[model samples]
Structure formats: structure tokens, C-alpha cells
Target: MKKLLTMFITFFKIGAFTFGGGYAMIPLIEAEVVDKQNWIDKEEFLDIIVISQSFPGALAVNSSVFIGYKIGGLIGAVLALMGVVLPSFFIILIVAHFFLQFRNNHIVDLLFKGISAAVPVLVLSGIDKLAKSLDKSVDNLIILIISIVAVTIFNIHPILIISFAAIYGILFLRKKVD
Candidate 1:
């Protein structure tokens, strides 16, 4: 019961304070779940990030549910999800009510512009962290290059790229021992 409450409060704080999207929440999640609570190690956290991204939902919510389940089962998952979602839900409701009034305000425009500028930095920080953790093996490098090219030049969907990479890994990257 205590642990469930803690999870709810922690995720509520994260959801309430985080300005940008999932990428922006990574550092905060890491600090709380990995560093402060010691629920999972860094490698496990990285795995959670990867798994969260691979799925369809928002990364922050997915990760919170994952961690909550790991800590306290199905009820915990529900609690954590509720915790993270409630803040955004209420904020959006309040903002929606007043946003039209402020839509033409220059100060509000400037504030949004500043927030937009900062979002990329937060996203980049997440990319840097993920990059540092990636194994620099030749096959992995090839896959990375292919994924970049496919996304940037060919404008391919990321899901297709990830699927190809998974198939490639299974078919050609398998290890054999005598």
C-alpha cells in the first residue's frame, strides 16, 4: 500500500512538472526510478526505454506502467498510470478552457516559442544518452546507418525500419559455436 502510494506520488510529480513529452521525461524518470529508489539498474532502465519506444503508446506512460508493474503488480500499474495521466488531464482541461482567450497574447506566444526551443534540447539529451549506451559493433553500426538513411533520405516509416532491423538481426547476426 505504501509503495503503491509512493509510485503514484512520484509519477504524479513527474507528469506534473515535465514540460515536454516523453524524451524530456527520461532524465527525471531515471533519477527517481533508477537513482533514488533503486528499483532498477541503468541497463534495465535502458531496456525499459527501448521497450517503451518500440510499443505504440506514449513513452512516459508506458515506462511508468512498466516500472509500476515491476514494483507492485497490476494494481500498481493502474495507480502509476492514473498518477501520470491525471496531471496532464487536468492541466489540459484548464488550459483548453482559457487557451482561446490567450491565443493572441504576445507574451503567451513568446512563452510557447521558448518552450518549443527547449524541447529539441531535451530530445537531444535523450538521444545522446541512448547513443552512449548503444553497442558499437559493426552489425549494429550498419543497422544504425541504414536506419538513419531510411528515415532521412527515403522517408521510410520507423516501424518498417525497426522490423527490417529485427529480421536482419535474427537471420544474419546469429552466433554459432563449434
Candidate 2:
């Protein structure tokens, strides 16, 4: 019970203050879940992030639910998800009303522009952390390179890219006798 409450409160604070939306939520999650609470290890957190990205819905919300479930089951999942989203929902509703009226304000526009730029940087940092933990073998590098090239040049959908990588890994690198 106390653990669930802590999760809810901690995520509520993170979700309430974080700007720039889902990508920006990564750092907050890392600090709380990894550094503070030790609810999930870094590898598990990264896997959860990857899994969340491969699906639909908001990535941050999905991650919160996943971590919460891992910690304290269904009830915890509900608490964490509600903690993360509810404040943002209400704040958006209020801010959207004000924002329309102040749409032409230069300061507001510039603030948003700055935040939009930073969101990508934050997301990239999360990716960098994930990459550092991965085995940087030649085959893995090749798969990563192929995935990037296909996405950049051919605009392959992410699902197809992941599928191709999986198939390649299975066919070429099935566990062989050491």
C-alpha cells in the first residue's frame, strides 16, 4: 500500500512538472525509477521503453503503467498511470483555453519553440544510454546500420525494420556451439 502511494506521488510530481511531453519524461523516469526508488533496473527500464515505443498510445504513460505493474500489480499500474496523466490533462484543458487567446504572444511562442528543440535532445540522451548498455558487436552494428539506412533512405516503417532485424538475427546467429 505504501509502495503504491509512493509510486503514485513520485510520478505525479514528475508528470506534473515535466514539459515537452513524452520524450521529456524519460529523464524524470530515470531519476525516480532508477536512481531513487530502484523499482526497476536500467536494462529492464530500457526494454520497457523500447517495447512502449513499438506500440501505439503515449509512450510515457505506457511506461509508467508497465513499471507500476512490475512493482505492485494492477492496482499500482492504475495509481501510477493516473498520477502521471491526470494533472497533465487538467492543466492542458486550462492552458489550451488561455493559449488560444495568447497565441500571438512572442514569449509564449519562443518558449514553445525552445522546448520543442530540447525534447529531441532529451530523447536522444535516453537512446544513447540504451546504446551504451548494448553489446557493440560487428553483427549488431551492421543490423543497426542497416536499420538506420533503410529508415533514412527508404522510409521503411519501424515495425518492418524490427521484423527484418529479428529474421536476420535468427537465421544468421542462432546459438551455435561455442
The candidate maximizing TM-score is 1
- Residue pairs whose backbone atoms clash in candidate 1: none
Please report how far candidate 2 places residue 149 from its true position, in Å: 0.6
lDDT of 1 by residue, 1-178 (tens): 9989998999999999888999998888888988998988888889889888878999999999998999999998999899889999999999999999999999999999999899888888878877887877888898999999999999999989978887787788776211
**Model 2 misplaced stretches (Cα beyond 4 Å):** 169-178
Q: For this target, which candidate reaches the highest lDDT against the unseen true structure?
A: 1
lDDT tens per residue, model 2, 91-112: 9899988988889999989988
User: Clash totals for all models, in order?
Assistant: 0, 0
Off by more than 4 A, model 1: 174-178
Backbone clashes (count) for model 1: 0
lDDT for each candidate structure: 0.89, 0.86
